[model samples]
Target: MSRQASRRARSIALFLVVTMVASCGTLPRSGPNKREIFAGSVLQEGDAFVVSVNPRVTAATAVVPALGFSSVFRDAGELGADTIRPGDTLGLIIYENVEDGLLTSTGASASLIDEVQVDSSGFIFIPYAGRLRAADSTPEQLRRLITRRLDEQTPDPQVVVRRLAGDGATVSIVGGAGAQGVYPIERPTRTLSAMIAAAGGFSIAPEIALVTVTRGNRSETAYLSDLYKNPHMDIALRNGDRIFIEEDTRAFTVLGATGTQNRLEFETETLSAIEALAQVGGLNANVANPTGVFVFRNEPEEIARAVMGRDDLIGTQRLVYVLDLTRPNGMFDARDFVIRDGDTVYVTEAPIVGWNRSVAAIFGSLGQVTAAGSAVGIN
Candidate 1:
């Protein structure tokens, strides 16, 4: 062969070798070990009992009697307006006409005293009336007490008692909400949304927002999202009730060549596989083998038997779902695949691509060495 032709052939061979190496390097090895991946699998799909976004409360369903300043005084059967409870601060106003002689000057003299905090004993101290029973007594009732006391000394004494501070009949919100604090219910009626707002709203994602409400000794779980979607489920809050926001216990894991490899937490009630993938920044476009995405979940065998027998699963049952992303129709099926808490999604790399990349690197190094030798020879 001619010298120039021989050199050309050698260059072509080198190029082919480099190309093959690069292609080989790009391909992944044996995909991820199926057993290992399955062992670490944390993905599953099932109906999870979660708190309803708009939880329905049997107590809140019925119309709550209006309890206000005047309502307490009215003889109507409306729960006679809620009275001042323990840990309440109240204010009082006393108005005396100048002709009453109780005041040195005339002209409807009035005295205002604030911060009359109710003690644990349910009593508040009045300027001249001494300690009066306030806990469980309506503002009107308290006003009557003050008026009766002053009536003995003066003709027609008018008194007013109002709650100035201390959650003016509030519901305490605890647990997973944005702010865990007491929410005040000013009117006789307040809804779940109002209570949530008073507690600074929910901090966790709505998909996983679980809330529990405890009234008296009874506790019930509710989903805030569902409640929001269906207004009919929205329940009113009552006095002496405590609300708790709980952390989402359900979660799924995304592994392999995805953009982010971590356990993605979600509410078992609403997350689908497609949605979960989007949440984790989607699969790694360059490395993900569109045809080899798989999801492994623990499928409880004899679930019916277990339910009938009340048997607890000790990890005896499981299932694996392999999905192909390359097929156009597969996307639709994938979209409907719901993700359960503890489900594991694995995205494998295309084998040929890894092999190609490795081969490319080897040939690239050889080219560099060859070029260096040529430079040295020329010098």
Candidate 2:
């Protein structure tokens, strides 16, 4: 090889040797090893199940359940509009045979009633029917009451009642909508999704939304996207129901040698390890140790016990989950791993990289020495 090419070959050889030596550096001192948390094969069937944050760990197969808030929707059912109340407007039409009625002066033999607001006493005054009770009465029931009373004075009476300018039930919506206000609940079974759509939908994708529903003294919350995935979560809306859509405020912290180290919000409630990494701009390829991608969480005692193979474990233990992207199966594990709120994703720096830098520094020193020798030899 030429002189310059020969020096380049030697530098390459030194870099490789230093990298190998650094790879075998001493292990960090720590407490006794817990159960072999280092996993390789897929968790088989009948293995001790240790999972949380959307839970998919299983021995044979991973089965994840829908959000717990789905049950709140189930219990809500539908709101009814069968009963009338005060502040309701009613339209009435009365027709009577003037020839048979002494009270009629043959005016028009018909009466056109504009609109009558129901009084707080649950009564509306009709010309011939006198004061009729309309509150808490369905349209059919009120029509019959007017017909029965009119018949007593006139030979033949016809009466019609129509609801004018009032709604039976309504719900209130607030936050991130084109129009945030109270909206009518017209359908017998108005779902949470329907209400949101009617109110002009959300500014962002529903999957990235956190929705809260308040009814009476109880308030429940769920991800807007989860409601779409599991239909059961699209709960029935009731009268006086208040719904609010919050931003995708859930975030996790990223540390160590990732591309970007900071707290990042989730685009959606459900995320895998790979997605979390992508959120933080993935690992720092040049500096990160792919084998040391760890997701740290303070697991509930039950889950820690199961995964740690310790029945005696309490619910407050912290856990470190390792994912080696350097291995073929590492990506698969990452894909299946779920990330929860407040988790910390850390990527370690590759040790071999440090040693490689040292090799470069040594070569740099040699070049300076050789350049000085060349000047002296020339003199």
Candidate 3:
């Protein structure tokens, strides 16, 4: 071997070694990463933006804070207990002694008046008794008034005032109910639940429904499922009140390396990140980067200000939250993170390993196809 040949061989070997090392894998470059939203500091200590809820999803039921509905209907109205209102019909009966002509035509006979409705003026008319105030008076109070007005015609008259159930307090229910239209409340103190039940409950599971109660000019809304947990939401219903139930319009989207990807309806009012992930078929273990799970949302101004300490928010705005499931505490932290409506949950792809497998599979398929074709040749 000559010196020239030895030198050339050494250079060629060195070049091959360098190429193999380069082809193995390149260093991760420093640049803007995927799913990066500027103005968000990396989730760390002292950052208020990443607010983590402390409760885990031990069960299917999740906690949802009432949105301006809790304080409004927490207590029942005192007026509807026994008070009568106009448009209500009363069944009346009169009793008097047979010997006392001043009081009697017959013994313990019912009033000829089948039923009397309180007029718009809040007055009911009797045969001997002139118009008497019925509205704002209890059945007992109206009974006393009716007997007292007939004192001149009868002696110690006994009277009964019964509310006509057919014409009593009623509520009109529409949407998401088993039965729709107006339903009469049998009693004055019928609750929200009773009225809904009277109208035939909800069409879908109450777990994912919202109830809107409108009483005259005032109206309020609450999650139907939460009513079971919070009784105050089941407030008493009044005459002419309107109740409606419908499936929740709020939902979040899931995409990227998750087992299932779609805009999923929340069967619950609210859910945390871990719970949301579970609901959407969880992370795709084969391709998901355990350290790159993220939730993108437009947080309300108050939350952004309180949690992120940012003042330049125009109502609700976008925010990016990153969760690293590679660490033991990552899932626990995600469990405590609340996912709001319109949120996007994304699990990014793991880079080098995933690409290597994909490339190998493509090459392996090509080699196998070529070998198979070579096996059969023209004779």
Question: What is the lDDT, from 0 to 100, of the residue 51 in candidate 2?
Answer: 36
Candidate 3 Cα lDDT to native: 0.68
Candidates, ranked, TM-score: 3, 2, 1
Provide the overall lDDT of each model, using Cα atoms, as 2-decimal numbers: 0.63, 0.69, 0.68
Which runs of model 3 end up more than 4 angstroms from their true locations? 1-65, 68-72, 78-83, 95-111, 152-158, 310-316, 353-379
* TM-score of each model, paired residue for residue: 0.51, 0.69, 0.72
Stretches of candidate 1 off by over 4 Å are 1-169, 175-179, 202-207, 216-218, 246-249, 267-269, 302-316, 354-379
For residues 118-182, what per-residue lDDT tens digits would candidate 2 score against the true structure? 88777899876789889878878998888888888887787778877545457888987757999
Per-residue alpha-carbon lDDT of model 3 for 1-379, expressed as tens digits? 5666655655554455446545766433322234342234545432224433223321211324555354556665634555677778778777764454443454534444556888887898887888888988988999899888887777777888887744556789999999999876666337887778777789987778888888778888888866777776778767788888988887888887778888987777668888888987888777677777767766667665555555776687555667787677877878777777778887776775555754565456545544554465311
List the candidate 2 regions with Cα displacement exceeding 4 Å. Answer: 1-72, 75-86, 97-106, 119-137, 149-156, 187-189, 226-232, 356-379
Candidate 1 vs candidate 3, lDDT winner? 3
Candidate 3 lands at a TM-score of: 0.72
Who wins the TM-score comparison? 3
lDDT of 2: 0.69
